[model samples]
Target: MSPVSPLLELDGAVQADGLDAGVAAHYGNPMIEQRRLLAGEAVVDLSNRGVLGVAGPDRLTWLNSISSQELRSLAPGQSAETLLLDPNGRIEYAMDVIDDGVETWLILEAGELPGLHTWLDKMRFTLRVQVVDHSLAYAVIGTMAVDPAAVHLAPAAPNGVALTWRDPWSSVGNGGFQYADAPAHPAADWHWTEALVLRDRLPALRDAVRAGTVSAAGTLALEALRIAAWRPRRATEVDEKTLPHELDWLRSAVHLNKGCYRGQETVAKVHNLGHPPRRLVLLHLDGSDAVLPVHGDEVEATKQLADGETERRGVGVITSSARHHELGPIALAVIKRTVPADITLHVQSQGISVAAAQEVIVPQSAGSVAEIPRLPRLGIRTPGH
Candidate 1:
């Protein structure tokens, strides 16, 4: 059994998921709640999320040298994100990072904590860094579509509150780059913020919610808005073969001009010379009232075989799906880089085929950032030479 959340009593009817997080998959009506969030009239409880703190003098520089982001100059209360990748440039973990002068806090899924802590502990060696899990010490609260100034005003119990983390997703930040070429990126409207407060402060927050002083939305509402924003989550969107470029994560979580790290060479090589093996796409699903597809559902495209018979060919797999208040049914899928750009897709879920229209998130032409010209073979000299 999971430990009860301090706010669980107020939202007991909400469906429960991991880490005893007090979130209903939907609170009776997700559509209504979603509107409340977009209007900045509701808060989402993130107490179930994980928080880790890195302390000591060498924390910033040490983190800069080990991750994809340039964090050595991280200012107090500034927000940034970083990814832990395998030496081969495959994503291993992701964390939303913030600093408060003395400690750098990382927010991620609870399941990622132990592994991250152990890994960081081992990597410390003789560095002046101490990593500590702060799940017991702090909790998180969030709101959507608010600017930085308004984000700082996010509701909080007047107790043990630490600091707020305004998501840097609205625009490209220092050292980061964007691959999504659409003139107007949907993520530009994603004004998400998470506030860190002492664990004991949650009860007071719950009291405020019960007293009608504040409103709350469930995870279902959050998911809908997130999908619409084309945001890639580490828990749902990542797999063993995942690369930052595949999901266009370089726009926020990666730093192109940063110092070398475990996977820097591969990140540089792929972005400058190679194309990602896969591409991330947003699927606007058929709204004929069909069953919604779950994660790992195969996405197929119509292909003509050699015999002149039309066959459904494999194209991709859905990573996350949700029923948006306005968009009805939507999902994020990962498809082959070689898939035809003009092909129409269909998602196969529990044997039910649902038509899917792709809205390019990562284009097939992505990569080659350095733009170095292709030089001729050494033996084939130019006429002038």
Candidate 2:
């Protein structure tokens, strides 16, 4: 667990639970906070998020050789996201990366730092790269405002360039692919950014909130907006079987044409010839009951049978759900790729069944973009023979 954030001491602050336990969930009015957050007048206390720094001259090149992004040419102050995958191509870590000439900063979930730090250290070998945990020294502040100055925070600029990481989810990154066929992707408007500030600055930021110079939102408001935007978070959307293609993560965090990395073969094969077994979707849940399905809640759908009967079948599980201030109750779920896009699903939440409508993110035909032609086997015998 991370050290409790000092912002929790603010009046009307309610600490969040689960993954965001150490931070404030809301400062009394989540709906108003969400409005402030969307209007670029609020900042979120993300002290629970982890920060890692990679120093030395070889940081960029070394990182490019091991992760899924093309980071060799990452200019100073440019923001990018990368993924570390296992041998089988399952996601192990998702990092928001930014270089500041002196060091490469990696912002990720607090729980992921220790393991990612250990693995990075072992990979250094003879390279001129050194990884250091900066989570305790620097805390993350999240805001929808693209400019850090809008939030009244001067982002750290140890190397003369600010350390804010602008999310690339707003558009398909170079060498990346988009599986969502929406004419207007929700992510196109996502201007989420994270700014690193010295941990000591928290008190001053809290004071600013008290003085009304700035407003403060919480992780819940951010999560609600993230869900509405169809953003896939590493901590919630990822499972042992998750593929970048499933959540349409290839749109931002992956470079499909990049050189070999740990799971490049599987990544290529899946994109070229196979489909991810599952796909991610945004669920518009029925809000009449006022019940919200928690994570891991079963999602089922009713199917009409040939015998004129109806049957309910399990189709997926809700990974993340929230009560959006505008969108009502919304959720992101991972469902079977074969599930019909027009189907009305049911979320079993707190003993009541809530109806959900699916908005396709990763379609059933998400992969096999290459459409490579199959050839006949040379050793096959002719039917007459």
C-alpha local distance difference test of each model: 0.82, 0.92
* Cα error, candidate 1, residue 42 (Å): 0.8
Q: What is the lDDT of candidate 1?
A: 0.82
User: Which candidate has the top score in TM-score?
Assistant: 2
Superposed Cα deviation of residue 301, candidate 1 (Å):
1.4
Over all chains combined, what TM-score does candidate 1 have? 0.92
- Per-residue lDDT over 244-335 for candidate 1, one digit per residue giving the tens place of the 0 to 100 score: 99999998999998779989999999999999899999999997856899789999988888899999888889998889888889999999
lDDT of 2 by residue, 1-385 (tens): 5577888989999999889989999999988999999888999999999999999999999999999999999999999999999998899999999999889999999888899999999999999988998888889999988677877887878779898999999999999999999999988768899999988888888888888988999988999999999999999999888989899999999998879999888898899999999999999999999899989999998989999999889999999998899889999999999999998999998999999999999999999988667897689688998
The TM-scores, one per candidate, come to: 0.92, 0.96
Residue 331 in model 1: shift from native, Å? 0.2
Q: Where does candidate 1 have its weakest 10-residue lDDT segment?
A: 148-157
Query: Which stretch of 10 consecutive residues in model 2 shows the poorest summed lDDT?
Result: 146-155
Model 2: residues with Cα > 4 Å off, grouped in runs: 305-307, 374-385
